[model samples]
Target: MSCPFAQSPRSTPNRIPKRSSSERDSIYEVIDAAPLCHVGFTQQEQPFVIPTLHARSGDTLLFHGSTQSRLLQAIASGRPICCVFTLLDGIVAARSAMHHSMNYRSVVAFGTGRLLEDEALRQQAFRLTTEKLLPGRWETCRQPNEAEAKATAIAALMIEEATLKQRSGGPNDIESDLSGPFWAGVLPIQTVIGKPIPADDLPPGVEIPSRIASLTTSG
Candidate 1:
């Protein structure tokens, strides 16, 4: 049931660097903090990429979209896909230009995608996806109608070939360039939380929940 990427080394190709325990730890952190991923694949030898919402169950990443979606159709046809989920923690600044680099954690997964058909499993996948974006959104939003559900497409990708790489240090400038006066360094960046905008159609008396308010200040 697991993607090929999550399998032992003997089971899949190693396209990226072998991930150490430290690297693995960082991957989990980055993935958990984000709910979207960039999926790359080739259709007819032409490269294609798409951004999709995803949920990580243990080591497998699940994606669901419209059945007629070009991306989903490509995957269902057995095309190989490369999924990259990344988090940018900060940009590093270095005294020398050559040494400048950003701090980042990312996971690259490759595999063939497939259509998910089990009714119960699809419901579970829907729930997992809902919980990832919002703690209790599924319960709050109106459930999907039969027509809506029928129009959707659910997919599960096996992590076959994968690796996690993280670069997070001062600067990697060459020793010779270290003496250079040119200013160079990662410009540390972060995702900032802003005040929540209440829904325009929301009832006048419905108060903003503390949870929604908290997200505004949360990293």
Candidate 2:
């Protein structure tokens, strides 16, 4: 089947010329690698954005929060929302200051969210989100109690339209600018998981799980 995100007007490129990504894999990769996303919505003609943890399931993206949150409440009522995920990979230094920029992967998605009301579906959403943030965590951690589950709100945004824009590699300088004395190169960056820190109240003799232990600077 054709990709649902392909060529939607909201997902089309309008800036940076060729930076708009056409490959669906690139879009999914960006979303999969990001732990947080900025969700934007409108209320009374005013715009607001909030950062929240998200997980992608097929063409849909899911996130949760306290049911009392204004943004979550609005989304639960079928409000249209714009979500953005970004990963900055490095700094590109160029001969000209105007041409200097950063290497990054970014995606913009548009959709209307709905509350997952069924208890079974809500538990599944919770499991998926927990595991996405920290692999294998859902199985190891305590499942939410009835009170906790009732207090939380889970919403899914069916990503009807989205776009992935990214830039990488070294500085792109013209022949004229190449002869300049200014230094031009890319300063690479990465996201690393440091040694796990345990809570002060944790009981002794407990060890880190294999999944959490596997995270590192390279991967």
Best candidate per TM-score, number?
Answer: 2
The lDDT per prediction is 0.72, 0.85
Q: Which candidate should be chosen as best, given lDDT against the real structure?
A: 2
Measured with C-alpha atoms, the lDDT of residue 41 in candidate 1 is 81
Instruction: Please give me the total number of clashing residue pairs in predicted model 1.
Output: 16
Give the C-alpha miss distance for residue 169 in model 2, angstroms: 1.8
In the order shown, the candidates' Cα RMSDs to the true structure are 4.0, 1.9
Candidate 2 per-residue lDDT over residues 66-147, each given as its tens digit: 9888878777778789899999999999999888999999988888889889988888899999988988899788999999
Which lDDT tens digits does candidate 1 get at residues 1-219? Answer: 222235446333354344332234555666777668898888778898899888877656778788889887877777778888888878888776455667887777777777888988788788888878876667767777788878988887766656666677667667777677677655676776687777889988987666556667642
Cα-based lDDT at residue 107, candidate 1:
71
Instruction: For model 1, state the Cα shift of residue 152 in Å.
Output: 0.7
Candidate 1 overall lDDT versus native: 0.72
